[model samples]
Target: MLPRYFYNFSTFMSMFPHNYLIYGADVSIVGATALIIFVLTYFKKWKWLWDNWITTVDHKRIGIMYILAAFAMFFRGGTDGLLMRTQLALPNLHFLSAQHYDEIFTTHGTIMILFMAMPMLIGLINVAVPLQIGARDVAFPYLNAISFWTFFFGAMLFNISFVFGGSPDAGWTSYAPLSELQFDPGPGENYYLLGLQLAGIGTIATGVNFLVTILKMRAPGMTLMKMPQFTWATLITSIIIIFAFPVLTVALALLTIDRLAGAHFFTIAAGGMPMMWVNLFWIWGHPEVYIVILPAFGILSDVISTFSGKKIFGYTAMVVSLAAIAALSFTVWVHHFFTMGAGAAVNSFFGVSTMLIAIPTGVKIFNWLFTMYRGRIRFTTPMLWALAFIPTFVVGGMTGVMLAVAPADYQYHNSYFLVSHFHYVLIGGTVFGAFAGIYYWWPKMFGHKLNERLGRWHVGTFVLFFNMTFFPMYIVGLMGMTRRMYTYPSGLGWTALNLIETIGAFGQGASMMIMAVNIVRSIKFGERDVTGDIWDGRTLEWSTTSPAAEYNFSVLPQVTSVDEWWEEKKRGVVRPDHATFKPIHMPNNSGWPFLIGLSFFIAGFGLVFNWWLSAIVGALGIITFLFLRSFDYNTDHYIPVDEVKRVEAAAGR
Candidate 1:
């Protein structure tokens, strides 16, 4: 009984079977949405939300929004993980159907990597980078807003696929031949393509934005070498993004043409080369591994040094190794597919290049150890995460080396061993580092310290359960449990290990719940950070107020050395006088970015269903907004000195 304009709405609805789980989820989603809308309306806060949040161009506020969205995605992704574990808890379990399993895994990987991890790290970069470098804001404030909204909308498009159409079941990579219309024949894969394309555009813009910000906007006398380690990490990560994301964009665009326009770019029935998709994906994908982890590296460095009460040991070597890793990251993409008969010479070359990454990585590990050797160590929660990263990442790195051997990889490729190594590195390294950074910087972001006792419990359970969950996967992987299998027969000897892993998975989920409780509880009951420098921090971010002002600094700092703020503290230096304050020019907020993101979402959704009319309308909306923005000359204003003085006086600065 659907209308013609429904456009396969019946097909979409039929994809979901009539089941209590689906019904319960539907009810939950509806109730949550209604509750949120009612609360916002009842509080009469829609105007406040629109003015200060939706249309604001402040980097700090935008950063907070990104983190909030990331946390939400994390919950979704984590639930997907738990469901997968529940299905696999015992051999021959039917908790999830094969189709359902594939969709869950696909969404889990995409959401965690693209939506959760990237945004969380980028959010931190946005909130902290300009302050660390003493800039009023990023190089392009308006573009920065566009980056966040595009990412936000893109994530939304990907997430809604499960409920609207079917979710992408071709795996997170969406490899060719399988992902082609001849096989998938649904809107799910299209969601992946367009969603990633939109987010990828935003990611590339973010790279360009931060690159220019770091290079052009540092305080006086802050040379590249004098910058904080985290700033250096941001610079390098941005460069990787600039070079890496375009390949993904091109690959997604080609695949979209194959699906929507019936092209033969990656189709098997024509003059298409399917391997090209794999190559292009890994070319970007390998660098992407570095893209997420490198910032974590930076966060750990800053945290280790701060809690250790010392300058980061071997600073020059750390910078050199980071650059070395970035260069080598581009050269090792071939290692991911050495089993594809690329010849021994090709495999050997890539294998060697891959192992070489371990060298620089080892150098950095040693630097962390040396930094902590003789210093007064603070075993705070952030410090604990940083300290835990050392041993955990070493385990990940060693296993990675094992997988790098091309001859040995034939046995390990696509096996649980590979799965083990991947999670070990990602969770142990990147996820751990993110927690460290969040805890370290929470006060600066929120004007309050998370309860230390609760923080300890959070980190303790997380690290313990994290190890429990992922370590047993190595054993099951060795027992020949290939990933992506929805079910396995009994008597495979995987029952015990799988059961252990499921228990551990739930344990990790419990830890996440604890952390969530800590965050919510700390918001109201947490101790206020009266001092801007809560951790006796070493960076310029701590030089400003706990939750920095609209314009971060009253008088922009003048840098002289590495860890300039710390050095100033040692020398008994004082901040500049209020008499020296000047009128601060800042970018005006714009709604164009928000509107453009909406336009992209609309166009993307239309293209997902091959509805050209909707697509064209959305495209025109985008063009119209861009044209309007190009002619808008009144885009900036200035904060008067008197207003600045009044703000500072309130803060007791």
Candidate 2:
């Protein structure tokens, strides 16, 4: 048994301190949990949630789960952002102690990037890619379930840090010397190392699965050139993930060894050099930036071309640019630390390589502009986000190029200027694109549209507040405001701008809340979309019913053009042949994924507490499940022809 101190009242209560802020969080978490339980009990939805979602192998349902999880993380990460801003709102404010602020920022960066943006984009991919390619499901459906569950468990492990022990405070990068066993001997960095290892495995598997899916599973007539641009982006992004993630996996594993086994992979006192860690990290990290943004680029392409009622102008050029960006992404890691004495030759080579990415990227921007030029445009919520992205992303890109100058980067390194620049791109790029995608695909995902009036309010306030929050950081950074500072003395002259930034952060938070409200309101009573093409979209995803049937299409679509669905729409009859109805082979939903996720969570939790016996039990559970799965040959079922015909007829397909 564990020691009595481990479960002492004071220790139990430490996670929820007796302060107003913590009390508020405690109330919110408890109240939300109670409300959910009450609603589920009232509606008798536990079985429904379990059968339909928890055990689901269906790609569309899994995608919805991913989005739900991502949004929850977004709120969590956003709360961390608010706390950091609150602390920095005034000079020398003691609202949050230094340790607390460090933990918040670390969690904020790690969650937003790893748990929030990644899952959101992956969710979009899951929902759209197979549908776009005219496949009934991804190539390996059981593996898909495993991927999501692993990711879910990984995120859960990372999130439980504060509750069990102290949160990771060495920043998301978890640099060496700082993160070594001596400087940080807690289970906090252990969470960072292990949580990411678990999640990164799933990510790598997803990459291979999608890569194989795109490579071999497309509809009969679709050639590479004929594939939808979003599918193309999915292919390239998956390749990046496949190529880039192993480096991270190795890096994390080595760091884990250093921390747990007392190895000398990155400890300063040992022969290990910390610079190797930075290099390996950025090798994966730079490509990761592209991994998140490229899908959004694909999203913007679909959104602009649809809303403008134009074939995406220069489709071939867009593909080339995407491929170019992917290739260039791997060569620019050194630019992340030009001031680290990598020498002029090394820095210059990386700097020039970094700027070269802008060339292909700029080509894409111009292509989007051309697609909208003189075309009939509908300024819907998704299109509004896209339109806003052009100018804002351009500014971010410009600043990025400025940062790429090796000599000049010495000045901007680790400053608020660097912070401002990235938010401009990432928030302006990935977040904007995510919101656009959410709005654009709401009908397809939920069978109804979100309120456009409220959507406009959401976008308007978000953009305004986003600029107010980060744009001034550039000014303050030039005035010598360094980052990672919890508080500063009153004479620093950073107070006014920090206050503006805090107000902006809260404004952004409020807009996000309004967005949540809009989703709920619309789901209860929004415009129903019987026709699947809610946006007159130019891809195969719009060819199916809203919320899509289990077998995405009754008959696989024969693709011939880049905008095959649009071409079909122009001819006005996309009716599938009723005579061709057949039984569909589908994977059976299994409870094992949830069980597997639970086992991994248990192992991760035990490892955090150094409870080796508990960890061993959980690990054995994992092995047992794997053994059971390997021998159990019955993994699939068939949807009868009659059921397919009935569903198709009801959907008016």
Candidate 3:
């Protein structure tokens, strides 16, 4: 009874599977969506949302939106993980088909890295960096909005494949030959290429935006050496993003051409080399690791020093180590495919380059340790996460070093051991650090603190369940169990370890639920942070009011030393008089950024299904918006001095 167009779409049936599990998912999604719609409608917040959130380009608001999206994606990715673990919990389990498993794993990796980790860190950067550096806002407010919306829409396009077409099953890496049109020949892979392409464009813009912001916008008298550690981390990470993301762009473009235009850029039959894809991928991939992590490193430095009641030890060395790590990240990409027969000479060079990174990393670890030694350490939730990171990351780092050995990697390559090591590094290093930053800065972002007891519970359970989940992967991995297997026979001695990992996975899920509850409960009843300096903080951000004014600083701060706010506190330095207040010029919000993102999403969806007409419409819309933005001269306004004074007075400054 279906139309001819419906039958023409080969993968449409896969989207609506006959399985009961997918039916449950469908019902849950519908119910949740309806509930959200009902609440928004009943509250009459549509216009409020449109005017204040969707059209606004305030860095802090944009940052909050990014974090919200990241958290949502984390749930989706985490659920995918739990489902995969459930399937593997017992031998011969048919909870998921092999094909479904492939799709789930692919989405899991892609979502966690691109949608969850990257956005969470970048969100924190946006929320805190401008305030720390005493800048009113990023250099290009509109461009910043563009970055966020494009990333949002791109993620939307990628996620919808699960229900609209079919999910990408080529792994997050999307290795060529397997990812080629001749092999995949579906809308799913096209979604992967175009979705990442859209998001990657936004990422590159963010790097440029922040790079210019930090280099040009710091407070007066704040030299490069005098900047806060998180700001420095943002700076270095921006450099890595600028240099590294272009390679990814090119690789994705080449693959897109191969898939859509009959090009053979990554195809073997037409003289295309598949390994070139791997080389290009890792060229971006290895540095991509640092992109998410360097910011966390910056966060830990600030948090560690703040809670320890001491200045960070070896500040110069820490900066040197950060830069060293960023520079070395590019040289070690070949270690990812060391077993690919790139010859011993090539492998040796990359392996050594990989291990060389450990020196700077170890220096950072020791610096954190030394900073904590003999200090009045406060065991706040954020500080606790920081402390837990040291030992967990150490295990991850040692395992990484072991994997870096070219000859030794042959045994561990593609095993559960490798899975364990990857999770330990990413979850231990990046996730732990993100949690710390969130807890440390929650008050600054929201004008209230998350409940301390609930936060402690969240951190405790997360760290415990996290270890229980991945540590055993090492043991079973060495016992010859491989990664990405949906089911295994019982006699292989892997069932017990798999079951243990499954239980831990669910516990981790519960921990995330605890965090969700903590956030929701704290929003209404949490302790208010009226003083802004709730942590007795060190940076310029603490000098501003909680949830900072629209213009971050009423007057640009004059910084004279590292931890300028702390120094000001020591001297009992009063803020400048309101008599000094001046009109502040701020960028007017525009809807073009949102429209542009929508256009990209439309084009991406069209391209996924090879619908050229829709793609052309989206491309034209993008051009139209850009043209409009160019002619719009009314893009800024000034807040009078009285408004600034009123805002300051309301904060009781």
Candidate 4:
């Protein structure tokens, strides 16, 4: 008690073993202060955020949230891509260390697949599926809310790994030996396992949600045969997600037990078989690619039809091919590791399946071509991306077939060529389709059109850069350049191509920046389009209001054919008569989903620091939030029938 300040310092010092406890206390105090400030700022306004944004189970809002998360993660992953690209831009650069490169790639792949592409696809599906199917909302709105929050939480956990401790560096696949505890003595791998486990739950839930909605909630007049092609793609994608994601969950769980508790599922020293992990991972991984690209295929089908002013050609054949591809995707996982000595029979079987996929995929290409063959085509930005897909995907597919030759794979496996092969398809197939879908649907989602001039600039820059960046990797792979090396010797004749690739990376980055600017400008002052039939859209979505309402269709649409809305326009079926007035019940907003997300953030920190107390507190926070939210039984209410009638009347005008 010699001095009051000295006493305070002593107390703080006593709380920590060394200086370690100081950061913890400081964080705790800051968090406590922030909580107080949050409460004070919203003293009486808590209801506003809750009612307006949080708990409203509107599909469009949910979709926006998913897309928002995806975009945020995209930049984060892209920066990682640039880092990796720069690292390999020259021989023996040593610009970044091996450990850093490992984490960069691991985070990039994990985030790109789980956070970027998956959510982008899901967001588009959420916004478009209900409208396309003529339904008011998803079949289970509460489940939809839960799924979105769960995904948000998983992303939060993954990001938190960067701040506290480390992120997984075991590549996105997290193969064994490297993934084992003895090899990776840090929290990174654990973060990956836990984060993905959480995300897997959300992904599986989403699959179930869409499946039930598509199968059971179609409008009274709609039948399977008359379903839009996008819905068919969604159906197959969901089936694959539901079945495949669970396998991933199991694999992650096994890995977690092995890492945390020494259970020996993948450790050779513990009588475990590492190949089991490989098998389980590929079981999920192969289908996971289809899970992404299939929906893109569907988007292309619909967009090409709309812009071409024609119905999708050979619709039945397209559907059949999708089903076949989905079936075949599951059987081709072994092909990924053909060079790993899986034996001639195993390799031969997977090679055939791998090559077999091209047939259905080729059929889809022909169908798209025929759809655009005789019809008048508009060169909209979305159509531009679709057209770009033709050559880009074909190149990737050709490399894929080349790799399918098991002997050739022996030469290409783990080489830069294989890397080029996947980037071609993954980027050309999934990334291009996502961009096209955004351009196609932006009017309906945002009530304004993206700047067409800027859009063209972006497409032109990105296409040229993307090909320039990846095309040479094929040459490098053929010249015996292996992948995953942090540095390479200069005399391998890989220098010129690598430098060219780096320049391409910069071009792609600049193009992305242009897109970001375009979106921001569009939201502020871009020209708005009033034509409900933007692009003379053939799907039900175009029939709804621009920037679709929270309840979607006020009166559920009746689908009389596959291109129901298109057919309606042709027949001059301008409006469905409003029989009577009824209140539209909608989900009320609640803060608990966000509260749940915040708790996961805290729990992730706790796990990273080995703080048992913080973990307990976080768990309590999550449980309390969920429990309080469950007591909210305010799901059903009515949208006034008069209100609905008036809105429809105005829409007719």
Candidate 5:
């Protein structure tokens, strides 16, 4: 049987004459573009932007760009969430048609996970990790530039779907039979597959890049075990990315061939098994959850220890926990579909593996608590986020454990209850952790502290409404509300809760806007940190100047302990001698990465509409650029001693 949403790939609904939603989107896009153009024209800063930012290979600058882009995607995805809320707020609400609703949610999930969360984390990593480990930059600065630009263009290609082509209506997973060309006959699914493929390529490169960086680039005497928790988190995350992302690459490639070439790899006919796609996706997907979460765990560990004025209690155990989680993450993919007739033996094995993860996780929690035990704990905004994450994430984990029970999962499968549980885990873990890191490292990134008063307000409002928004989902889900239904009839007793959820959604949106306002306000008025160690931080990053110089260190600090900088501060020691400084060799700026990203994007756009000629031209451009890069050997330049001294002196070093 054909799926409910099946349609031809070439279908384009030309009903825009009367569609308010399409018109609204069109007006918004136009207005936003006009505003951008007007601002750029008035400021005449495009040259400045291009010279410094667009082509720069600096890790810190690249990281900031990632954050900026991620926030924009967040807004886009969040709006989609609000639209869904609006539709479900009342019974039979026609705020969106069924097809439109499916597209919105699909885009929301994809954007939040791929464009928003992953980039945000990568950006933060690019910003802080090199500094934290006392490295000048990532293992491959040019490759880092390529990674960022490719991701940027990939995100743009995906975002343009609603305007230029039809939006994808399949779920973010885009399960096989439904995602096949017959059911999803549009450029939308193609965009999803290819955009992610392009972005995933960059991500895999990033994983390899950082894996080498973290492994080989630490300052002298900084052993693997003595690295900061966040660095350790990043290291593990990079490893997970390397091991797990390739599965996605292969899976997406197979699906793309299946769709475009009429291959039956995942189709029900011709020996194709749809279950293989599920297995492959979650094999990558489950670790992806950890890929995002383990970093947060690392961030939380740092926040807890810093605010409590204590060393992390289970330093060894913390490292063990992170590694264990990454290892265990791959073993539990079967739990996602225990009810798909995998039988008791298979399900039980996965169920046990899934449940076992809680041990290391619980160990991490206790370690944080023990760090806080008998210490003076400051309830700073970052610390507050760490504190809130404990119980909330614990609850999320409990619910996850609940779902892992195979027989029980059979009941909860496809229910909003599962949706609520993961949200609790994801929001509680990743979202709060990101905020904590943002607040903790704000000065390091931008040279000014975010306003404390505004930080408090933002956190309070967001946490309150976040709970308000999704907590009731558990209730409604248990009350028989199935997942992904566009509407419910008036008499199911779900109206009141759904209405409350919508109100909460609005509150969350308002809180995010306020956070944005706080960011803008802080740029000029926030506290100035001439001293880099604003938080009395314990890592290598705090050993340098705020808004660190291009060469992160004039000379690398030799680490003697886990919190080496903290130990040095306690001993009243200063920095390494700079009088004998040598010239610093750094990579020169290049525009090749930007051009290559553009070439890939053009090729992808051509492929989206099956424009063979355009695709060919774009492919040729990409090959030409690669050839040009091969012949270019003047990629490095030196900062002489005088210039290095000048920059260091200006930072009060």
Candidate 6:
């Protein structure tokens, strides 16, 4: 028997309007124009953006670029959120078609999770790791640039769907049956698959790079135990990405093969089990949440300790709980689909495991609290995000626990409650933490601190509006409003909350605009900051000049304790006074990383078009770039001893 609401691929295609062809043509023209502009700009004397930005492999530069890219994607994703909120504000509103709504949530989730949050975390890791450990650069500087550009190219491919054809309408998870070729034959889904796969390769590359960097690139005397909290988080996050993301790669590949090559990993009539896709996807999906949030945990820890002017509390417990969370996060993905008839035994096991994760998380919360106890807390913007996170995360965690009850999950599954729960955790934890890191490190990254008064506006309005928007989702969810539905009957009593949520969504938009204004003002006209110790920081990061140099530390510090800079300062160790300088070896810029990224973009487009020749060209581009890189052999050149001596002499060291 046919399942309910079945339709063939051709019939499904006929449902959409014919306006897409024009849209695709317009997009192609725009992309071609942009490429021409890029070429013209680089060929002119405005080559600095390409030379200093595109080809430079400095971790700080790369981190800033990652963050700027994420913010751009954030606004793009926010537009999706606003549209979803507007459409759902009133019952039976046809302002947006069901197809459009599907695309909204799909791209919203994709852009936010994969492009915005993940890249922001990568940015944080890139900027902080070398500074915290007193290293000159990441172990693989070229790989760092390659990884970031690769991800950027993938994001470009995903966004290109808007012009060339249409955005993907499958949900972000792109579940099987719904995502199979027969159901979603458009090139949009193909774009999603290829774009994410290309980006996934970059994610894996970054994971390996960070893992090796942390393991091998510490300062002269720093040990594992002495490593900062954020470094530990980066280590664990890298491990999770390395192990968990491959599952997604395999699942995505199988889906692509099923769509393009007629293989039947998920086709219902061909003895393929869609359940395998769900199982495999969630195996990667659940841990992916932790992969993004783990760094936030580290960010909160660092912020708390710095603002509180104390050592981190119960460091051993914090470390152990982090490990526990990483290990346990992988065991609980099945809870996402308890309503799918996974059997009582399986659901019960996953439910219990899911709830167990809360324990380690709770332990972490207490560690932060104790770290802030009775200490002089400055309550900076970063600290504000940290404070807000505690209660907000608890609420989200409570909802998560409520949903973890397998028997009760049947009510909450596929409901807005799940949506609200994740948004709370995601926005409250990861997004807030990312912003906090920005405020905390902006001075160090760029030679100026962000405007504090404007920052207050950004933080205050964002928190207020964010809560107002999402809190009502819980109420509507409890009243039995299901998720992903474009319209509903008026008698459901869901209009008021939805309207309130829409208004809050507008508030979020305004807050983002304010943030943009602050960023712009700070860059062009805001007060200049010359202080090395912006925020009177406690870490070795502050020991270097603000807007740290290409080689982070001229002479690697001999660390003897935690908060090494603080201890040295307390002992009256003045900069340029008892400090000796050494010659620096730094990597030169190369266009190879950019070439690799461009090739991946080409390969992604070829996969989308099923053009073998284009694919071959892309492959050759990549191989040639790699082969040429191997033979260049001029990766590192030394800062001469005389140069080092001159700098030291000038500083009076």
What C-alpha lDDT do the candidate models reach, one value each?
A: 0.92, 0.89, 0.93, 0.85, 0.89, 0.87
Per-prediction TM-score: 0.98, 0.97, 0.98, 0.91, 0.97, 0.94
The digit string of per-residue lDDT tens for model 3 on 1-653 reads 23533554655655555667666777887899999889889999888888999999999999999999999999999999999999999999999999889989999999999999999999999999999999999999999999999999999999887766778999999999899999997788988888899999889999999999999999899999999999999999999999999999999999999998999988988799999999999999999999988998999999999999999999999999999999999999998899899999999999999999999999999999999999899999999999989899999999999999999999999899999998998999999999999999999999999989989999999999999899999999999999898899999888888999999999999999999998999889989999988999999999999999889999999999999999999999697799999999999999999999999998888788877777888999899999999999999999999999999999987
Residue 142 accuracy (lDDT) in model 2? 80
Q: List ranges where model 4 is wrong by over 4 Å.
A: 1-49, 608-610, 620-630, 649-653
Q: Which scores higher on lDDT, 1 or 2? A: 1
For model 6, how does the per-residue alpha-carbon lDDT over 1-653 read when each residue is reduced to its tens digit?
A: 12311333344345334455435546666887899788877788457778899999999999999999899899889988988888888998987788778887899999999999999999989998899999999899999999998999999999877656678888898999889989987778988898999889989999999999999999988888888889999999999999999999999999999987989999887799998889998999999999999999999998889999998999888889889999998999999889789799999999999999999999999889999989899978788888988888889989999999999999999999999999999999999888889888888898887888888889899999999999999999999999999988998889999999999999999998998999889998765556567787778898887777677766788898888888888997765432356568899988899999999889777777565566678988999999999998888888876776665554344
**Residue ranges of candidate 5 with Cα displaced over 4 Å:** 1-18
| Higher-scoring candidate on TM-score, 1 or 4 | 1
The local lDDT score (0 to 100) that residue 627 gets in candidate 1 is 99
The predictions' CA RMSDs to the true structure, in order, are 1.5, 2.0, 1.7, 5.3, 3.3, 4.5
Q: Candidate 1: which stretches are off by over 4 Å? A: 1-7
Model 5 per-residue lDDT tens digits across residues 285-324 = 9999998898889899888988898889989999998999
The alpha-carbon lDDT assigned to residue 2 of candidate 2 equals 57
Residue 625, model 6: Cα distance from true site in angstroms: 1.5
Alpha-carbon runs more than 4 Å astray in model 3: 1-16
Candidate 1 positional error at 429, Å:
0.8
Question: Which of 2 and 6 is the better model by lDDT?
Answer: 2
Candidate 3 yields a Cα-based lDDT of 0.93
Q: Best candidate per lDDT, number?
A: 3
TM-score of 6: 0.94
Looking at model 6, residue 503 earns an lDDT score of: 96
lDDT accuracy of residue 282 in candidate 6: 94
